[model samples]
Target: MRTRILLAVAAAATLTIAGCGKTPITPADSSAAIAGLGSEHVKVGMAYDIGGRGDKSFNDMAAAGLDRAKEELEIEATEATPEGGDDEGRLGALNKLIDSGHNPVIAVGFQYVNALTKVASEHPETTFAIIDDDSIKADNVVSLVFAEEQGSYLVGAAAALKSRSGVVGYIGGVEIPLLQKFEAGFAAGAKRVNPDVKVRTQYLSAPPDFSGFGDPDKAKKIATGMLADGADVIYAAAGGSGAGALQAVAAEKGATFIGVDSDQYQSADAQLQPVILTSMLKRVDNAVFQEIQAFIKGDRAGGTRRFDLKTDGVGYSTSNQALIKPLTPKLEQLRQQLYDGRIVAPTKP
Candidate 1:
């Protein structure tokens, strides 16, 4: 089923690029025009990370943006997950998109750097946008990264304030610089609020193992341990793994969990719903949608594009209206301070 979808997407992308500059095509026209070129109407393609679709984190958020482009911008877009493995699958998907003639092929995670760097160089005419990691530099690629530290800092402060015990916990999917930025910022924020606060940090896996991000068993075990050690609030930066952490929090009363990447409060299970105190919002959907819009408008660029707290790219969610109401005033003040240069959150690990 997935392979068939990828082939269809590749064919559509080929047709779109082959038909460019001919006529403004609508959905009805797409079939005929693409058929003439022996292609389809797949104009935009997004290659998802290892976490893939339905993780309720990074990839899901990017998919939302692609969906927006399809609706608002009248572009035909589809998402592809790497088939073989993380590295091989990412490269294969990227190559397929470019070979099919997609203009701005979107890569959804930082894990695509090596694949994108090679693919972007080979196909200079193709534009690429990567999220999270930005080690790659190419004239045809745009790097979209967020200030997780700033938002994590705010959530950390909130956790500190709400904790009956001075102990808080941070559970990461994998120990990478990106995750480290969350750890550092959360620690800094907690310290700023309460110097004596004890912040316990752990990762589902060490390194060379990206599989941990989606591992629920490991996350649950880690969270359970932290809860037993007196952690009242646990901030989970572990993609799908965080779901397990939320599960642990729900099982134990008087414990709270902080979400990441999106407004998880809205999507979490009803049993664990109230346990989610706040979520660190990384506006990947907004960024992806904007980038796709730019491509449609012919404004795609290269180099790194930073989305921070100042730009409203990163922050905490107020999805639960009643809960967020009280924090609004303080959040607004902190937002202004971040914008006015009064506060500088760490960008890199």
Candidate 2:
């Protein structure tokens, strides 16, 4: 089920947003996948987004995939975290891995688009995968992007259904098309469920100022303000900043917090766990594992590989015991509607 479609980094083709974008990258034939991963150990490298591994969100899921590739396919993988989110910082981290003789380097965030585009062309001998971004048109780079808005719609519906207060809040790490899609689907879903529901949205920072993803203090303050304004249910799409929002939720007694990317219900902070009503489970792990798997199979063509509801790339996490259980039937109906073209989650603010 491997087909190829050229993806533009700056523009998108007519791929359905609910279907993981343009290409239908079903798992490559199993025989080829196994043969591609012969008995030899494959060396894989990764550069994480800001906040790195302990962020317990996007980067952690990327780590899980790399770890699984090592354990199951006998690959030797090393990861590097950037000191800053700027192009220079990301370039240094990527160059460090390349210097260590790592091939098929993986850049975990769209913030690395500039660095990856420049470096990938300079080193055609190496292969690279960029998660959450597909603007690069290099033949050596694979765009491991997902239909985030589709899954976000599901959780947004959940938030609307569970909110005792008619108002809900959304917190985003950075203001970009990537995070903006989350905001769009969330607000859309809430409005779809109940037209009058007020959805307050805020972004901690904009592009080039990528500190928002890991800034707990600012996220906490933002969440505190949103909750104080009658937002009983809040969703945080700000990576580690979400942890701070959860902290605020924990202190607010009756408030509920929704997580994004990873399952916040499994947080190390036990107090944060119970406060998490649900998480928009974006399967960063699946996209990472599959792209790396394809690379192993000698499939290094640069193009768009879409992961969506059909590919199990995104959904609502079951971290808490049935937080969305009562709404499962309705959720499933809405999910099918998304797939069948009845519902279209917006990708813009």
Candidate 3:
């Protein structure tokens, strides 16, 4: 029932992935080595965001990372989602994971900041990593964040280049500063390409109401309105609600949808694939994998790690090659500018 929350704005300083010199835990000896972690093999806990694993977007990417660790690194894993989808639920989920002997628990959303802050203090020995948030300043916690604006900027330019109506739309799951980064970067990129480009923006929900991430029906209504208003290209950063935008865009001829967090076109339905012009790939899976990899190597430093274009942490998908091919050259040029520090994407709207 706690409504208090700390909003995480993107950090300005970019840090590379940290490395550890501790002896690596081989698959055969990992079980006996990680004594306090779990009963058997090295066990990791995954606490998913609102829509959980099957969301086919953010949460799914986190799951994919965990799955990769399990297969490649030979680690045991247990995953859980918030039953009530609130701060209390987040705390409960974390507690459940730790109680089950899973160490190095990864909370797959910024919404877990408060819950993680409390649980982390209680379990000082248990290492924790939070995705999309860097507000926690604890030794046992690491913030796995991404340069969302950079990726969003590229897609926004793509949206503008692909738009015939001169107006593009942005849909945010919630009206938080974090989500604002996506809107800001998208608008800025669009304007950079076409100074007179029109950007339509809206949020499905506000603070204390995170239901927006899961409410596709409302997103559908909003996207429908944007399309009717002459938006030919729409970029949705609204978690699972983005599925609705994809469906809406699919039904409208000559309209395109930009996906976020994952390569949504691959996970999207076969019929909805064509409408997906491109997706802003926030490599949450790679972040999760790196966190687990560092942990297994006995690197317990809970410092913040930033994933940006320099590290290939975020990017645009190339699934719809035919549609995106023509725009590739320009997009790649813009991407290089971002990577070379020639262009800096806005982190705020």
Between candidates 1 and 3, the TM-score winner: 3
- For 246-300, candidate 1 gives per-residue lDDT tens digits of 9999898888888998778878877778888888888787677767655654555
C-alpha lDDT of all candidate models, in order: 0.74, 0.79, 0.83
User: Of the candidates numbered 1 and 2, which has the greater TM-score value?
Assistant: 2
| Per-residue lDDT value at 312 in model 3 | 50
Sort the predicted structures by TM-score, highest score first.
Answer: 2, 3, 1
What TM-score does model 3 achieve against the real structure? 0.88
Q: Per-residue lDDT tens digits of candidate 3, residues 110-131?
A: 9999899999999999999999
| Error at 28, model 2, angstroms | 20
RMSD to native, candidate 1: 9.5
Backbone clash pairs for candidate 1 read: 12-42
Candidate 3 global lDDT: 0.83
List TM-scores for all candidates, in order.
Answer: 0.85, 0.89, 0.88
Go through the candidates in order and give the C-alpha RMSD of each one to the true structure.
Answer: 9.5, 5.7, 7.2
Candidate 3: clashing pairs of residues = none
